[model samples]
Target: MFMRKSKFRHVFGQGLKRDQCYDNIRITKSSWDSRYCDVNPKYVAVITEAAGGGSFLVLPLSKVGRVERDCPLVAGHKAAVLDIAWCPHNDDVIASASEDCTIKIWQIPEGGLTKPLTEPVVDLVAHQRRVSCVKWHPTAHNVLLSAGSDNKIYIWNVGTGEVFTEIDLPDLPLSASFNFNGSKFACTCKDKKLRVYNSRSGECLQEGPGHAGAKPAQVAYLKDGLIFSTGFSRMSERQYALWDEKDLSKAKEMNELDNSNGVIFPLYDADVNMVYLCGKGDSQIRYFEVTDEEPYVHYLNTYQSKESGRGVGFMPKRGLNVNNCEIARIYKLHNSGLCEVIPFTVPRKSELFQDDLYPDTPSDTPALSAEEWFGGKDADPIMVSLKGGFVPTRKDALKVVRRSNVLDKMPTRTSQAQSTNSEAAAAPSLPPKPSTTSTPPDEHVGFDPQGILDDMRKLKLIVKAHERRIKTLEEKLSQYEVNTSEEDEGKA
Candidate 1:
């Protein structure tokens, strides 16, 4: 017998709000770095330059949409802003990397910026070439890092403007991410190699061959100290490889996927140990779960759409729904607009609490000084609590996924059809009893190809008719409900 499935099942939910996609938000098409905030999910920052040099515009997100009237615009970078990273420790502060070869830190007031924030809190001017990516320290607060074309990565204190470590390399770095404990970082370089460096000592911990193509690669750390990288092969096929961060002697698993024209960017969810692979020109985000076993990468499902994305942004775990077991939320950027994709757990309605949804998510804690981080101690990230949580539920929180669609839920239709065909073809010779009772005309008893098609078409038409009637009734009911609610309010 098949083993029982887990109580919590993860799947995509309806996009939260209407009028979701925002158009003409200034975003750099070339840079792969995230231009939105992951720490504070309430606001999102983007580079918007309709008339001239791009300025940083912060939009306060509401359940309905972004509040455009009170949006704040910070103008400081002389050139187009390539990347923006919000400080995980402080929600009011953010940093921007620009093509001016300088990184600027801007502070957003609590009530939202009334006027343009033309001045920056601090500026670090050291990179020789254009800056590409800026990432805040995961565990250590106030510490930020920036990589530029000057073939150097600089880690500095965002508040003091002090350089803690400058990693000089021979090649330009593409992407960089701190490990789980912030002891080390794995970065991708222009030479098609992944190099993991010690955070405090700036020593190379490991190096190995990645996707082996000319295009830039992206890397991220996994739950079991394994690091995964995505890049293209010599044949121009997109692929990803997983390796142990400590031992780069061999890759744990290397898998090639559908050959596409865009580079695959991996978005990891530490809460669920699932990695979502999204490509530049693709309309679907493919995800897989990594386990501690052979064939570690288990194929999940794909979320598809009609339009493709120029860029995608992932929200932090703390912002996700702890009650519903939300794995991740992706913001897909199209040429005209932006769309949010949310993945939620499909738990049984009878379940009391989903234990899997609430992992120790990467969260912010008290800021640590530079001395504390360099002291060679493990710093743990704060996690959102699961047991005795804030959100209250009345037994059944989320709706149940009912298997009401007969055709959609049926799994043995094909096998049954094949068996019927085989039996009809290889049947024993019929006895003379078939001639009894005036020998009724031999009707076509086997599966008729046209008959099945006709039946399916009829069923589809009937479903559509029923759907139309239901929609009409729902609209009328909604109108009546609104009227009744207004009357009740008046009575009250």
Candidate 2:
């Protein structure tokens, strides 16, 4: 039997033992369409159901065992968290969108959560309705994109807490993905249309019909200007399609898989050009090799399991075990409150580094800044070699400088007085100049008394503003105290 001579043909999935898996977790039961989980080399975050608010649990990758019943949670959102994404440049930074109609960015400590994390570093409040999705830019630092049920898409500069760009869609976007360079993105919407748009300008360059079925669909932008999507057919059968960026009016290749009701998620690895299709509530993961050849998409293999998965998260390439010939790792969330670790490895007899299977992959360093990406500048992702294994660089703290009103920037009266005193003291005593030739008003050498008066007026206004702000804060504090007392009384 002559098989397709490919490096990934012998790839097999190996599941870790029960002791190595994370157990006793309370995964969310929200009907929202999301992975509900995100994994990095350092930690794994899973959304859990909370009583009065939404929360997620962050666990260290090394702490693989039964989770404690009273584990600390990242509970900042007043409503259920719909989606979450980890920043590519910083492992400790994450963004979460919630049904509270807001998106919050959180920073975890190096050792994971020691107590309940109730505060977020940045809170973005622009969506008029519940936010459904959040995605970090692939190659830019401090850049994030979010979609809301209000039919609006916002690109944010997380560092400065300002919207870099905005895109209005005809309908709610079901799924969205950024291209290699962060220059463009493709989206699948509830209107059953696939559209590609400019990331900065928000111009729709291409639009076409998507899957005919009414269920949710997912889209992923590939390396060589290709798009992969998965959705249900008109007959309710699950199907996947490949499309050329130049033409979306028709799929380059479309194939039907099964009649499962769960939505299929297509995860693409640009290094190997392989796409893994994992469906919610399905026990198997089907992967395919995408090429520019006749068939375009080739079926590689499937990894089967007995327990069904509620959600799944794929780890980055740099986290794989190169010595064990591991190419990819997936963290599968089971309905039984267990997170299983599955590693996909290519069988090989060579004891040396296999160059064929491992190429230069995307490094953690970002190639562009949010300002550059929003200013019409584009660059591909920075790549690094994995021959000697991966070592992460030290990341600085994520500082969020929010936008403020003009009054907030005004100098205080005490500082202004200090500046005036300093200026007067630094003046060289000229022994009273003898009131020399009558100096023209335009060429006056002395400080303007009128200007001092203006400064005094401005300082008074600043003082009034500060007093108003203090009074407001005092009122809020009193109200909060009253509410707390009432709540205590009710509990008693």
The number of the candidate with the highest lDDT is: 2
Residue pairs with backbone atoms closer than 3 Å in model 2 (clashes): none
Give stretches of model 1 more than 4 Å off.
1-10, 20-26, 29-39, 63-71, 341-343, 350-352, 386-492
Provide the lowest-lDDT 10-residue window in model 2: 401-410
Per-residue accuracy of model 2 over 154-243 as CA lDDT, tens digit each: 897665455677789999999999998878899999998999998888899999888999999999999889999999899999999998
Candidate 1, residues 168-206, lDDT tens digits: the string is 876989889888767789999988878899877788888
Off by over 4 Å in 2: 396-492
lDDT of 2 at 47: 94
lDDT of 2 at 177: 95
Candidates' C-alpha lDDT: 0.66, 0.82
Question: By TM-score, who's the top model here?
Answer: 2
CA shift at 345, candidate 1, in angstroms? 3.6
